[model samples]
Target: MIEILNPAKLAQARVTGALVADILQALKSRATVGTNLLDIDRWTQTMIADAGAESCYVDYAPSFGSGPFGHYVCTAVNDAVLHGLPYDYALADGDLLTLDLAVSQGGVAADSAISFVVGESPAPESLALIDATQRALRAGIAAAGPGARTGDLSYAIGSVLSEAGYPINTEFGGHGIGSTMHQDPHISNTGRPGRGYKLRPGLLLALEPWVMEDTDELVTDADGWTLRSATGCRTAHSEHTIAITEDGAEILTLPTQDR
Candidate 1:
């Protein structure tokens, strides 16, 4: 399903997107070295409720994941990258954590993710991984606009990651998002330019650029939801929901202060 939000829905989407971004930023601040993953999930649930928003993840039952995610947010640590189910483990110093969140407000939805180190002792490798994903995310966003092809965005994103020496994984990437969490026009982290769907006004896309430090392979954790690097290397993911408009792509998921 590829959903294009009308102006009114897009307005509501901005509100939802800001809420998602604020919550993620707050969670990032609260995630200390000893914070437990389950605690993060609980915090996320509370935040979503306080904002009068519906969690796009808690009851989500997608074919790729264990039914009913049962968590408000994804807490990925160290080697874990995608679909990270909140667990009982407490974050350790230097642990790289990724928080992915989505919510709906006023019948509109937005999704975003951020990766950072848990404590003050972040490793150089972890920092590099995080930086690479962030840069690639920016590149992807820069390549989006009305009339631009999805492949152009992918190529821009892939160039950054490839130059940074990280392996790209295509199994899970960005996609169109509005009204629902995930939608069609899958945006791979890497692809050939001038190919794939052409951008149009009103189209919403969640452009995420994620990569593993060493290999492109992934291994699912015992929880059946968390996806980790096959070589157990550190990973990072950065994402934001953008709306294509007459001028260009407007990032809806940036923190309120950032706008």
Candidate 2:
């Protein structure tokens, strides 16, 4: 479903976005060496509850996933990428962790993700991979505007990943989000420009550009939710929920400090 937010609804969406961004930033700060994945999930639950918000993930039962995702947030470490289910694991130094979160506040939902190294150990390759995804996400957001087609955003994102030498996977990409966690107008990471759905004011889209270091293929972990690189290479993912407006695309998921 394609949802267009009215002015009042958009205002509520802004609040939802801000809350999501703040929570993500908080989680990033708290995640460190020895941080347990379950603990991270607990932290997320507490934050959501304290804010009087609802987790989009907790009881989410999408077709691709195993069942109801009984977690508060997605904790993707190293090879794990999308739909990462939190489990019993302690973070180690230099662990490439991706925290993807979505929350509903005031009846609106916003989704975002961030990738970072766990501790003091900085791996050049890991940093580069994460940086590439971030750069691609920026490119995608910049391409989003009134009248811009989904392909334009995809092309911009794909160019960055391709130039950076990372393989793209289209099976799972960004999508429309608002009033619900996922919606129509699928945004692929790679595509031809001037095609697909046309942008319009008040439309919300979650543009995520993710890539695996070596292969375009993915393998589902035994848990049936975590998606990993088929080649076991490191991966990175970046995402943001954006609203198409008259002036341009307003990135709702940017941190409060950045606002």
lDDT of 2: 0.94
Q: Give lDDT: candidate 2, residue 202.
A: 97
Off by over 4 Å in 2: none
In terms of lDDT, the poorest run of 10 residues in model 1 is 62-71
Best-fitting candidate, scored by lDDT: 2
lDDT (10s digit) by residue, model 1, range 1-259? 8887899999998999999999999999999988999999999999999998999998999998877999999999989999999988999999999999999999988999999998789899999999999999999999999899999999999999999998899999999998888899999999999999999999999999999999999999888899999998999999999999998999999999998
Clashes of 2: 0
- The alpha-carbon deviation from the true structure for residue 139 of candidate 1, after best TM-score superposition, in angstroms, is 0.5
lDDT of 2 at 33: 98
Clashes in model 1: which pairs? none
- The TM-scores, one per candidate, come to 0.99, 0.99
Where is model 1 more than 4 Å wrong at Cα?
none
lDDT of each: 0.93, 0.94
